[model samples]
Target: MARVVWHVPVTTSGTGSTTALRLFRLRDGRRCAVGFSSPEALVALLGPDQAHTELGEPALRALTAPLGIDALVVDPRLVAPSVTVPAATQPAAPLAPAPICPAPAVRLQRR
Candidate 1:
């Protein structure tokens, strides 16, 4: 089975949301982000209902350096990859053999 890992956490510390989309790490080892069209957007996305802790790139972009956020940027391949499934657990299978023909007896006609 393929192993899955989260990108850790990034803390915004409540800054830098004035511009640029917040970048952060996701649980699936992928970068996450939340782009706000306006100041209202940011406020709506991250409400002041309570001190919020979000994961992924959105949190990373909102985040400044380090804190409670455990966001960790990881390799792309770790998250997604182009792969081919094996036919069976073991390889080395025998192939079918070619066919053989019988000899025909030719009666010589003496002229």
Candidate 2:
């Protein structure tokens, strides 16, 4: 299971909403984030009274640094990478065959 190392609790104000960053250490030794995501959007999709904790900035930077990622900025006006349907321009890459075990399997009977 993925674990949250650092997070900020999200709370709503009178007319405004507040959200923070989140850093997650994935089960496969990878890191993921939700800082650029909006809590309001999450609530909209998941319905009202949703439960989640936002994350912090410093912790995010620290975690991303080791992975050669300097920062994670959110650009609202950013455009999608592909606008039209995708097509394969080149031949598909080849994959290596699965490795075989060096030792034979061993079985023991229970008493």
Candidate 3:
């Protein structure tokens, strides 16, 4: 069976969070396995990794009809880069605390 894969860029609703959707399509199958680059985002929505779905032919057609999806998934246009985390995703360094001054010692008088 022939299969097609696509990486579609998407943004979450009202959150401005951006990620890519990984779609796997099989010519003879009815269901598709939907995946995302950020698993955290998926957990936030579905609370699990169950991302598969079955959309009918019309729905699938409508999904790709506008984007000219065929062109984007073709060879030569898609390139897989080495897996590496971008600087923006890295954790920021913890801030250092300000130094405190010592209190002066007082002399005690005899009672």
Candidate 4:
């Protein structure tokens, strides 16, 4: 039987010697390690700019277990909502004026 290898995304530091595994957060705020079956699959979700390395399931699990991440998401399809910037031609809404309040009177006590 052929061993299955997963493509794991990583971020490289200077000289590429120091690399850190890329991790994602679940909707419930739990951290998870993400992997894909192939390079194409990884690129499809993370874009072409993402760097990845191949690792066996055991290796992937071992790497993340020490970090307290037990969830391993394979070929995850969930994506965050994209941010939209308002056009420059559109005018912003006016701000409301602050409310004016009368100053409180305070009596001073002589010691």
Preferred candidate (lDDT higher): 2 or 3: 2
Clashes of each: 20, 3, 0, 0
Deviation in angstroms for 73 in model 1?
A: 16
Lowest summed lDDT window (length 10), candidate 1 = 2-11
Q: Give the runs in model 4 whose Cα sits over 4 Å from its true position.
A: 82-111
| lDDT digits (tens) for residues 1-111 of candidate 4 | 999999999999979789899999999999999889999999988899999999998999999999998999998995779889877996879988989988999999999
Q: What is the lDDT for 76 in model 4?
A: 94
At residue 76, what lDDT does model 3 achieve? 18
lDDT of 1: 0.44
For candidate 3, write residues 1-111 as lDDT tens digits. 534332233334355454333444445533343433344544554456434333334444566556554312221122346698666866889999988989889899999
108 Cα displacement, candidate 4 (Å): 34
TM-scores of all candidate predictions against the true structure: 0.22, 0.30, 0.23, 0.72
> Which pairs in model 4 have colliding backbones?
none
Candidate 4 colliding pairs, count: 0
TM-score of 3: 0.23
Error of 2 at 110 (Å): 46
- What is the alpha-carbon lDDT of model 4 when measured against the actual structure? 0.92
Q: Quick one: best TM-score, which candidate? A: 4
Q: Per-residue alpha-carbon lDDT of model 1 for 1-111, expressed as tens digits?
A: 643322332234467353332355576655544333333434454553423333444445346344444444333223435698867877778987867877888899999
Worst 10 residues of 4 by lDDT: 78-87
- What stretches of model 3 exceed 4 Å from their correct place? 1-21, 24-48, 71-111
